[model samples]
Target: MSRSPTFVRALGYLALALFLGMAVVLRFVIGPDVSFTPQAEIGRYSDADLVALGAELRETGQAGLYKFILLGVDFVFITVFGLWVMLVHAIRGLGPVRWVGVALACAFMALDYGEDLMLAIRMGLATKGNLDPAVLTNPVSLVHYVTLAKFAVFALCMLSVYFVSRRRA
Candidate 1:
């Protein structure tokens, strides 16, 4: 292989390693257990029930932290992936359909990143327990799934590079 091809492959693998490594760190070290919790509107019940309900409500705050952590992973993964795709294209040609997949992946990753940033800010505010009623009602579930999907997409991109390099095209 040419020096450029070899270099590109090295960078791609490095990026993938960084992406997955960070993901693992987030899942275990960062705060996964603290982040995935439920947040229902429990204030509607009697004030006497507020103690038990309050505890449940607090669990949802962990969900917010969960998303904040995921946002960190998603942002790093997509930004690196965007570069990785362009690198693969330069090193080995791919059809327009494959290019479209890269483009779509970038778009999905971008959305995931933006949503995470927004949630992180809101979560910081929520930590102070000053969050608005409407904000509290908003669940972190959506962001959670989207962030996980972002990682999955990045993994697909990494695997595609190997296939692309091996193919005749």
Candidate 2:
């Protein structure tokens, strides 16, 4: 069964609010001006770069907190938000097949959250002063591949929105 239009819209708005709030926290609170912002291009990070990131996380006490925020909150919320974006069109009469976007959103979330978890594990090791580059090869490679897939899916989802709008217009 499908969800109500009002409920879906509310979820979408709530996701937006969470996103905005997190952006504020990332930019103003646990930010570059104080703590080194975590790298967005994590897939490109070398072993040394990961070590440096760990050191930054350790130095700024962001290792633990950011892990929770990124994996637990941001990842989940953004996935749900993307679902709402993709589904709203279908609910409004685009077609039921558009629900496939929901599946794609979940895949994006898995890739993103998996990447974050790998980094978080490294950060935890860094906090303990036990980070070893030799152990990072697999996770780093996985993160790189996942990041690529995640972005590709996300781009497709966004395009669906654009096309849907243009078709409606």
Candidate 3:
């Protein structure tokens, strides 16, 4: 049976609320209390040094990759948001499938949160009343690759759920 457009839109709103709600709680509420904000938390690396690093990246091979990634993420976020709409409509319509979109969203955001946490940890900021001494090590740079992969996996899971749910719809 098909659902009213209003009901479907309401479901979409609920899904979106769940998505943005976690993001907000993480960013504004939990993040500050447990993050590696260098200027405010670590403060060992001077701002000037960070500025130089940014300049260096802009002039090096890494800049293209970074820019490509940032652009890719912009597209990804849009896709995920669109999926929320699809899932919401499906749920309101009372189709055979349930929990697919929510499941994917949960998994996606889980890794997203995890990667963010790992990056925070890598920054070596003092959390839990302990400061990271090896914050500036070159070895830590490699870890970013793993974090990026986790992020990609999160996106893949989200996309997969969206497509699966969409196909079912």
Candidate 4:
């Protein structure tokens, strides 16, 4: 049941291409205009900040684009990036190290997805003018924490892969 090296390599390349493509699209094509996009803002943001971002998106008619980037492009990007990380670890064949990298990759993907979903929900509420402070607080906090977790896990995963590959070499 072992996969061929060629097959695994091909999949890794494909995943990388898809991930990069989506990244370009997000960065230059349909991404939000604000510099402090929720996804890029690793630091903690106030509920008020989140609310204002939503409002700005709505006012600028970028709300739909923001939601699309989160639920659509980013969804695909996260999946492909996670798969790419796992495949890289698999190719490295570092036993426990590989497994740890894979686990971290999965965790990163999950946190990213959760962060995007929470942001989308916040945006939806903002779009609907349901800006009750109570309604916004939980999602805003969730997005912030999840985003931080996602970046941390991603960094760990990449470091594990790098160290494993270097050690093998």
Candidate 5:
């Protein structure tokens, strides 16, 4: 399960590139007005808040772009970042602790994907004018909890990377 330093470096560069590209798009293209979407929100947001954001995006004619960023750019970014984290752990030789990093990477990526999927589904329903409260409840709740879980796991992943790097040094 060991990875070469070269491979790890390449993955890190790719992850960085993807992250920067996504950031630029979010900052410039999506802009600040529609920047406060659920995916970017760190904590639990109400169903009304989600609906309001969706409506705002729709009204501003940025709903499609927002969805594209979430489902498209963010998806690629999450996969690349997760793989980079796993590869870094492997390259650093964390011994038994390496497995924990790998598991954290997997959990982080899963939670992120789950959150994105829920938001996308909610957006889709909003776009179609079919955002029935009953249908929205489960997805909204999933997005809320999954977003929190994603952040916690991401923090753990970063801490694991730090520990591995420190051990290597």
Candidate 6:
């Protein structure tokens, strides 16, 4: 709230960079040969897709590694995004509505972490060849919905920042 516009802008840029970088790193750690598509962006995949992905990860022997790498990425992701929401609040000149962006960002972080943990558990089970379709159903659905809500709230926050900034300009 007390931050200058220029400082807020700098934080926003840094957050954007970290967010993209972590995403790219996570993708690479998951391996190029793996055919698994991330459900974070596209929502949940079909049961067959999950099975195929689990098989690929299991065969490639990278599921555990992926879990570790994703955990690190998720950490950076949430930190950077939390900064972004703060930057948004500053850029919006610190109002009650501006705090809504902060609230949404917190929600996004919680959901993001939950999704990461769920995926890690799924990967662990899959690597042990103990994962069942029935087990995949609930967590997968919950993660997808959480991801959708996270994105929706994030988009709203971004829009609020944009409109508010434009108005000030």
Stretches of candidate 2 exceeding 4 Å from the true structure: 1-4, 33-39, 93-96, 125-132, 135-141, 165-169
Best first by TM-score, ranked: 5, 4, 6, 2, 1, 3
lDDT of 4 by residue, 1-169 (tens): 2433675566557666766765665567545565467677767776567767777777777777777767877787687778767876777756687788788888988898888767766656424645577855653466777788888897897787667556643
Candidate 1, residues 47-153: lDDT per residue as tens digits? 22322223433464444344544455556666666776766755565567468556755765676566555445444422443445564554333444555565566
Ranking by lDDT: 5, 4, 6, 2, 1, 3
Candidate 5 TM-score versus the reference: 0.81
Alpha-carbon runs more than 4 Å astray in model 1: 1-4, 32-74, 125-132, 148-152, 155-159
TM-score of 3: 0.36
Clashing residue pairs for model 1: 35-62
Candidate number of the best lDDT: 5
Each candidate structure's TM-score, on Cα atoms with residue i matched to residue i, is: 0.57, 0.70, 0.36, 0.75, 0.81, 0.73
Candidate 6 residue-wise lDDT, 1-169, digit = tens: 3335676677678778867776675566664768654534575654445556666877878766665556776677577777777666656645676677677678777877776665555555424535676755653555566667767777876777666566543
Instruction: Kindly give the number of clashing pairs for every candidate.
Output: 1, 0, 0, 0, 0, 0
lDDT of 3 by residue, 1-169 (tens): 2433565556556656655654564456434443232212322343233333334434543433333332344235434554564455345424443455555555555554454444334332212213343544343343354445545655665565445444432
The lDDT per prediction is 0.52, 0.62, 0.43, 0.70, 0.75, 0.64
Q: Which parts of model 3 have CA positions greater than 4 angstroms off?
A: 1-103, 121-130, 141-146
Cα deviation of 81 in candidate 6 (Å)?
1.0
Prediction 4 TM-score vs. true: 0.75
Give the worst 10-residue stretch by lDDT in candidate 5: 121-130
**Number of the predicted model whose TM-score against the real structure is largest:** 5
lDDT of 5: 0.75
Stretches off by above 4 angstroms in model 5 are 1-4, 125-132, 135-140
